[model samples]
Target: MTFSIVGRSDDGKAVGVAVASKFLGVGAAVPAALADVGAVATQSYANLAYRPQALALLGTGVSASAALAGLIAADDGPVSHRQAGIVGMTGPGATFTGADCHDWAGGAAGDGYAAQGNMLAGPSVIAGMEQTWLGSSGALPYRLLAALRAGDQAGGDRRGRQSAALLVVSPGRGYGGTSDVWVDLRVDDHVDPVAELGRLLTMHSLYFESPEPSSLIALTGPVAEEVRALLAAAGFGGEELEEELASWAGVENLEMRVVKGSIDPLVLTHLRAAG
Candidate 1:
């Protein structure tokens, strides 16, 4: 019914999951993670309780294999119908596919990552995902998304696609640096849920991702005048152009891409478009 990748960044700074399924709202039930703890994806008659319980176990210093074992041991449900993948921040990963799972169901685990799929087109679904995760570069979220997209290309859930999700966690990565809930976008229902999730992820990056200092351009000369005009048109301009621009960017939820003394190229383009 679903396919997913659970992983910790190679740099060990983040943990996340990317998943897609024929089932509606698979995101709500299949993925879970905690920064510096671990990530898990439970499907094939997913045990929702396995979410928090597995994270708790990982938080308590349990290995991925041990944590998954604990979850299965305590479960009284139809064990043979369950499928799961676990990856902890500091240990080898693990995966499971109950014998009773639908045909074409199984999984694989490797250093810092695990991938699993049940009722997939074939074993290539998980294999393509694993290959992508290993060879991909860039941020953790993109790598996870690439893995999911690779799975989809390999023929994802056997039935069809309905929903997809990406969950990432890192201390202080959330909005305003107030939480660990970084990158929690979901496409509950879409004809092409994976593609939709990718678009949402891009929007998330634009709105929430921080720009490098080197990427910022000081607002000066003609650029300053341009910014001033944009701010004035937006009814946020005042005697202090720099302060007004920052405030306006904040109001538009574009502050993360703008600096106090400089304008990010992306932010400048946004301001131009908005004005």
Candidate 2:
């Protein structure tokens, strides 16, 4: 009935999931992630509670295997009809697919990822999804996207493709670092859901990614104004922003914060001038 990929970012500071289903609003039911506890994907006769309960266990130092046991033990559902995957905060991952999950439902778990699917077109479909994911050598977001595409190419849901979603977050990469969601986009019923997701991700990178302090670049002339324009266009502003920008106008190679909807005057000035 569903398909999903759950994993931590390469840097290990973030955890996220991408999932889709013929079912409506698959994002609301299949994906869940805690800033520190990892992620969960519970499908089939979907158990929404497993999302939070599993995270709660992972929160208390539970390994992915233990957290899964606790969740399964709590559920009375017969194993044949249930399917799920979990990536624990410790970074190890785990997943399970019941005997009765439609035609070709199954999964693979690894050091940093959990992949699962049910009601697939066939066994080969799941295999292709797994192969592409394993063979992928790219960013977490890209790998997850490729896995989804492989599944679709393999036959996808016998019912057809309707919606898809992508979400990735790092320790402080989220908005201002607290209660922030780094990437949260969904396509409920698009003709090209995956392609649309890729587009959104590209936009996200442009607006949110900031240069690391260690790689600070010296700026002069129109560079400062360009940087400010970029930041402003991305919607970052605040009372103290001007002060930070002023400092950057004089200092070269100073690291600047580029938070959306927040002020980081130094980065703002650099960005504005760079443009």
Candidate 3:
């Protein structure tokens, strides 16, 4: 069984999902996303084909419900067992839990989001997942993690935790420019997968958080001296490098824009050591 969150970012540049389960390699089994198209999670006696085929359908302007319906119609055993959720590019979402699934199985879907789980402790698992998604107020990854945590708190897999994962994608990162994935994380096997997932989520946020607007960090006049000293201590060189850094400016709150390449390197260093 599993619980998850799939949703779009506020600025709409990103879409993704995060999930955790008491199953082996849940990462490999439960989550999928395509840049700017949509995201899906299939769990509990999953049929992995649901991922790529659904993404293909989503890319062609099909709605989440339609894509899922197509899958069910095409499959000979659609009703035998399993659960799934889909979120389309236009923000519509839908979910299905087969009648043959194990105890405490079902799902929730809505605009810009979807979540699903089967073989859970009770209906509260799905309800807590939905509440966590509705309750979260920050970035996409945080919301997803919150939902997973909520599901766990509400009695997740009656079997206990073993694996977790998060998948995210967005358009034109650097290469293809049409469909560039931004984030994908997984905890394949762990004694406490959700705990590992939270640590990973904290590290993931530093890399993907957007730049803050200039109006919020316009310190000028004498305050510039203090800013220079702080930057120097933090890693930037003296006034010349500070002047160069000033071109991007407001590096404090908007750390992503100023960090090397992207924010992932430093976060990874810390995480690797922690794990």
Candidate 4:
């Protein structure tokens, strides 16, 4: 009923999970992560307690393998029906597919990543996810999303897709640098949840991520004049261009991309499109 990957960044500063399933709201059930700790995905009659319990073990310095083993040992419910993947900040990942899980159920694990699924089309789904995750580059969220998409393309859950989710975490990576949750997007129900999840991730990047320093354009000369005109057209004109622009960006939920003396090209593009 589900396919998922649990992973951490090369530097061990980020960890996350991406999952899709025929089940409703798989995100809320399968994925859990903590910056500098680890990540977990529990499904196939998922015992929700496994999420927090595994994190607690990781917080206490347990390896992914040990944490998962302990959870299975302690579980009071039918352990034979559960599936999970765990990845720690500094060691190899671990995965488990209970004996009673539906056909085509299995998992793979290695340094920094794990892939697993049950009720899948075939082993190719997990293979495709692992290949993409190992070969991909860039931010952790994009890599995770790419791997999830790979699984979807490789004949994902035989039961078909109903929902999908992406979650990533890192120290001080959340909004205003106040939380560890860098990305958390979900599609609880959709005809094409994986693609929809990708779309939401793109919007999340624009609204929440800061621009690269090299992508910033100084707000002076023609750029400044153009911005002023655009702001005025948007009914945001003011003597203080920065202040008015900040206000406009706040309204547009692009405040995180706003810089005092410069504008991100993406933000500028949005301004022009709005005008």
Top model number, TM-score = 4
Per-model C-alpha lDDT, please? 0.92, 0.73, 0.73, 0.95
**Which regions of candidate 3 fall more than 4 Å away from where they truly are?**
10-13, 172-179, 208-210, 214-239, 243-255, 259-275
Which window of ten consecutive residues has the lowest lDDT sum in model 4? 6-15
How well does candidate 3 match the true structure in TM-score terms?
0.77
Q: Model 4 clash pairs?
A: none
TM-score winner between 2 and 4, please give it: 4
TM-score per model over all chains: 0.97, 0.76, 0.77, 0.99
Ten residues in a row with the worst lDDT in model 2?
A: 252-261
Give the per-residue lDDT digits (tens) of candidate 3, residues 3-54. 7777877676677888888788888887888877888887767889989988
Q: Which scores greater on lDDT, model 3 or model 4?
A: 4
How do the residues 177-223 of candidate 1 rate in per-residue lDDT, one tens digit apiece? 99998899999989999999999999999999988898888888998
Model 2: per-residue lDDT, tens digit, 233-259? Answer: 545433344455544433443322433
Model 4: per-residue Cα lDDT over 1-275, one tens digit each: 89999999987899999999998888989999988899999999999999999999999998999999999999999999999999999899999999999989999999999999999999999999999999987899999999999999999999898999999999999999999999999999998999999999999999999899999999999999999999999999899999999999999999999987999999999999999
Q: In model 4, which regions exceed 4 Å deviation?
A: none
TM-score, ranked from best to worst: 4, 1, 3, 2
